[model samples]
Target chain A: MSQELIDAITDMREEDAVAITKKLLDGGASPVAVLDACREAMGIIGMRFETGESFMPELILAGEILAQISAVVKPRMQQGGEDKKLGKIVLGTVQGDIHDIAKDIVGFMLDINGFEVTDLGVDVAPEKFVETVKSTGAKIVGLSGFLTLAFDPMKHTVEALKAAGLTDVKVMIGGGQIDENIRQYTGADAYGKDAMAAVAIAKSWA
Target chain B: MFIRPDNWNQMSPLERRQARLDSWQNAPTPPFVSPEAEKNYRERISRVRKIYDMAPHDRPVADLFMGANEYIVRRKGFVGKDVIYNHAALREPTLEFHREFQPDVSVGAMPYPGKPWDMLDFKTYIWGGQKLPDNLAIQAVEGEYMLASEYKEFAADPTAFWMKKYLPRAYGALGPMAMLPDFPRISESVDTIDLLVPFGLPPFQEMLKKMMEAGNELMRILGEVGQTGAMVVSEGFPGMGFNIVKTPFDYLGDTLRGTKGILMDMYRHPKDLLAATEAYVPVLVNSIVGASDRTNAPCAMYVLHKGADGFMSQAQFEKFYWPTWKQVMLALYEEGITCYLFIEGSYNTRLEYLAEMPEKSLVCHFDKSDMKRVKELLSDKFIIAGNVAASLMSTGTTDQVRAACAELVELFDGKSYIMTHGCYFENTTDDKIRAFIDSVRK
Candidate 1:
């Protein structure tokens, strides 16, 4: 039954997954089992995305279906005292760059993977980053930008974090043009090529 | 510093160009006003012409490979925020920067509607922090502008479907267009103008006035900036502002059917997707040919988006992408204009298909493709431009930039190659720019 649920999610049968997830839970199937199946399906989706067998729409759909499935299962899990928080992380598109789709994708991926994400949205300032870190206690900071001009703001944000004595916070940058060269230029601790890499970076920091 | 010719300020742009063209065509006694400057200009032109013709003249020729944009504006010490939002303000500073660079070829900016900030959709326009920073390219936030069921309607009458079904859904301002009643016979009679009395009403009048003002502003900006481009050429730089076309699949995928929506359509409505793609071919061909003829430009720029290696499978590309794009290029070639294919992402697997193109008919400017493999395959048949590491130009030292350019020149030497960036980038230093030109020279 759980395998069927996994297949439905991985195959992008959104309606089927939603219906099947409800049926399984109502039939007294484990909420934890249903959630596990969803996570397993996300792994397959992420791998396919990385392999180029899938594209943006598939990733987005998977995120949506999972969110729907999570909505149904989260209450059950909470009632049973089964929720596990991975870690808190703050994510945002850096200043001067309004591109947030990539950042949104990364955030969605992290949330499903059991991270407590505080999304700062797009065009976040350095002060905002520092403040968010202070408030949320998010140890992992994911800064996103898709333009070349994003390098300086990224660098400044990193410098600001260090200046505010948040040097222990792990800062990672991701976007269209980001690479090791940009990572070094921006003073980021590391950089990711895609959402999966962002998840991996957060996990490694944790 | 560039010294303007006599009465330069007095001459209109056309007269100035005609005078310069006359001088170039005639090659009067002494070649130029100053002997040394004449020799230098002649040498540069000769070198560029040799590369353009693929003749046995120069070993490696470097033409300037950038557009005048906020990148150059910021490099010239102006804040991008202040100038990029105002089209009229962009003219002088960008032109002055171009005068300073004085590249072998002047590649001018294509006029997009409104100011840079104003061109974007409202949500992204604000969320993206209004002043466009250098590295950012304009992207529409992904959404389904057309639903899956709308494909049949779209295929039935694309124009009406776009106006009635798509435009309202995509843009908030055009939301009222959805309420417009169909006028099947409005154009059939001259009395329809009088029948359409509501169009002259207050609300409609205000909207019409706003549109007219916007249109007038766009024209003024185009004229002023386009004049700057002509002036660049008049000052002895061969101008290149080729018209770029998107493949129909990309067009549908990008603008109408959102990426996810299109991907769904690919599975659910494969035939509709194919039909829409086929329908777009003539539209693309006509636009390319029409623009080329109108502008008298030699090359048309065909930017291949969403057809990259990983974007779709080889089979999907062969079916959905290559056929129409191939048709567009062949059709353009038939019209005496070759296309410069700015291959945006890795196209390694698709090179075999592209190689089937008519020899010397396309220039491939690679961005993410493996440069060595590209040379091994297509360098013999096509005029290859680049895959220069833009990240290096922005971050690496001049020596690193020179070393990379030297490597590319070595592979592409005299083989109809113009050393250029694989793609445009931000924060590239003047020294690195010089290194690219110098490496090609030496």
Candidate 2:
């Protein structure tokens, strides 16, 4: 199981849906088995990160590798609907900025840590976030952005959520270019300073 | 349009003094290196520019730059109020692990800011370079550093000039002093660190820790290295890092989005970028300058080739660079900190821009820039530092090191400047460093 996981990590060319499915089938890994392996390997990568043994580039690369492997194992996991729901969270980068380094990490972190994360990707305007929250009734909204201009849309998104009567849903944010003053000003429920903290905070909030 | 308070001239004396105190209290600080060990730290760092006496009066400037640390020392009145510490940048610090360490010296521009210095440092890293996939600002160009000085000059601008004329003008309204939401500053610094460490799980904690240790030794060496130029804002600390950082525009130029993102947005929406930059300048500058009380700005751009002046072909730099630098610097000048920039890489491409930078601005260090010309254009008003290339330390003999120092000495023609390397020092023979210092001081 470990060897397969390592192979998947090393062989990262298979992105998108097809490669993920093919690889999982080829490795004869079940959904539960795949999740365990990915969790274990990602934990190692996380340790490396905590010890300063890793940089952003490496952490990103590992996450990309895990994502590809997960794509391969998704179908098998569906066969076992008995797994814990762990709650659901919707994530996206704020509007007007398309950078995704922080968003990607947040998504990967939530996934690896057993959260049902619905990542909406980058440059997502506030309307999309409100719509996602309403449609999914997600209790946690994780927003990310690289530009300070995002502060407005973020505030508007929260306000929109309140307007939509989803005030109880916790809202969190993280990114490289964000600062503390933004959190206090934005009125975000919490600020996840980085990817790991984003996951930890998300879980705690959930 | 934040017009001046209409009640000007009607202020009580106490309110006026408090305003002065608040402004003074919020100044940013530069990096710290132990001045006692300046000589040694000088060898590790590439160059030292002594343009102006940073200690304007008899007051030690370094102490003023590391403002918070000194504030801590002074508020405690550990030594006594009248007892001015002679160059106290490298104060003793105790880390999470019960270890008390006296970090090496640092050189900064701020003297006594109230908070920690991360706001200035992280913001610079994000916006200092030329590599964002998109320029995010209307003024962004393909290549060059982002020193937002013009942000300091926004009060004079009109409303249209502010909203319609700036790039990322919205940011101009946000910062340490901004009445905007708290998401910007707080989310970027420790909040990001707090998240990345646990959530993102970075891999460089140990390396960063070691780098931090190594970074200190470098400070110690520069601490006592006999300075020849007037200390500008770098009161006593040297950490403002001889002021250079890789242009992020360079990041985009080489990446997939290339110039399509913010670069296009700049030419397509030039007026907006300019206006936004104008509005953002003061708050950003205040946040930047007041973030730390350093003697100079914190920067380092030529790290890839270690302050390469001759390394990059001119055409490659011009085509893939130049324009972004012009915009970022123009913005920095709009703020008042343009006077504190020190160009680390090739100045050949933009000598005029370098010259046109705020008067007393250019601190030409670690490049093959024309020695006589830099002197002719800037030395009187600007603070030129060093052209002592690191190659001299390793590749040359002792006599050669002496000769290089002599040549640099002669080139400035006895104008004020600091004697040091063209790049960072590594695997260096202590003797070589000794010889370079020995020759220059004489």
TM values, all candidates = 0.83, 0.38
Native-to-model Cα distance after best TM-score fit, residue B271 in candidate 1, in Å: 4.4
CA shift of B313, model 1, Å: 4.0
Candidate 2: CAPRI quality band: incorrect
* Clashing pairs for predicted structure model 1, backbone only: A98-B128, A147-B135, A147-B136, A148-B135, A149-B135
Docking class of 1: acceptable
TM-score of chain B of each: 0.80, 0.42
Give the range where candidate 1 chain A is weakest over 10 consecutive residues by summed lDDT.
Answer: A75-84
Best by lDDT: 1
List where candidate 1 sits over 4 angstroms from the true fold.
Answer: A50-52, A74-80, A83-86, A111-114, B1-68, B81-100, B107-144, B163-205, B260-271, B315-320
* Residue-wise C-alpha lDDT for candidate 2, range B1-442, written one tens digit per residue: 1112356367653333233223332334343234643443343222222223221221101111211222223322232211111223323211110111122224221222111112122122222122222322211222222223332233344232333333222232222122212233456555655434432333334334444554564454345222311232133323333233334233322221223232332333345434443443344335443432243333222222211232223443443344444445444433333333334444554555466555543345544456777777767655566655443443446776677777767676556565545433222343454554455443
In order, what DockQ does each candidate have? 0.31, 0.01
Compared with the true structure, what per-residue lDDT tens digits does model 1 show for residues A1-206?
49999999988888899999999999999888898898889888878877768766567778778889989887777554646788999999988776666787899888877799999998799999999999999898999987666788899999999999997899999986677878888789999878888888898888
C-alpha RMSD over true interface residues, model 2: 17.4
lDDT of 1 by residue, B36-115 (tens): 44455566656654554455766665554542244565576645443433445656765665567655565544344534
